[model samples]
Target: MRPLVYEQTRFSPRVIFDAGNGVFEMEGTLMLEDNKVFFQTINRWWRIYQQSPNPQTKIVCKLNYYTLATDNFLMQWLYVLKDIPNVELIWYYNPDDWEMQEYATTYQSNYSFVKLKEEKVR
Candidate 1:
C-alpha cells in the first residue's frame, strides 16, 4: 500500500503513515477547525491499512499541543490501534510539562489495550 502523508498546517499536525516501513507518526500541533474532514481521511486510510498491516507497527505521537477536537479524533484512532495485535504506541512529551504527562497517563488508562509508553524529552 502507498503511504499517506499530510503536511502540517498552522492549525494541524504532520501525519505520516508509511505502510511500507510500518512506521506511523504524527507530530506537531493539532487544533484544526476542520478537524472532521482531516481525521476522517486518516480513518479511511487506517481501515485500509488494517486489512494488510505490517508485521510490526510503531506509532509515535509527538504533539506540542492539541485541542479537544484533535483529542476526539485521536480517541477514535486509538481505538483502531487498540484492536491491532502488533502495535506499539509511544507518546512523547516535554519533561517539564506536567499537563502533557497527565494527559498521556489519562489517555493510556482509558485505552488499556494500546500498551502506551510515555517518553519524556527535553
Candidate 2:
C-alpha cells in the first residue's frame, strides 16, 4: 500500500503512515476547524491497511495539542486497533505539558494496548 505522508502545518500535524514498513506516526498540533475531510482520508487509509496489516504494528503519537474532534477520531481509531493483534500504540507527551500528559493518561487507562511515555527534550 502507498504511504500517507503529510507534512506538519500550522493547523495540522505531521502524519506518516507506511504500511510496508509498519511505521505509523503522527506528531505536532492539530487545530483544524474542519477536520472531517482530513480524518476521512486517514480512516480510509486505515481501513485498507487493516486488510493486510504487518506482523507487528506500532503507532506512535506525539501530539502537543488537538481539538475535541481530533481526540474523538483518535479514540475511535484506538477502538479499531484494539481488535487487531500485535498492534501497540505509544503515546508520547511533553512532561511539562500537563494537558498532554492527562490526555495520554486517559488513553492509557482506556486502552490496554496504549503505552504512555514522556517526550525527550530535544
Best model per lDDT:
2
lDDT of 1 at 43: 85
Task: Candidate 2: list runs displaced more than 4 Å.
Answer: 120-122
What RMSD, rounded to one decimal, does every model reach? 2.0, 1.6
Those runs of model 1 whose alpha carbons end farther than 4 Å from true positions after fitting are 113-122
lDDT of 1 by residue, 26-72 (tens): 88888888878988888888888888888788788888788865777
Question: In candidate 1, how many Å is residue 83 off?
Answer: 1.6
Cα lDDT tens digits, model 2, 9-79, are 98889999998877899988899987878888888888888888898989998888887677888777777
Give per-residue lDDT, candidate 1, residue 95: 69
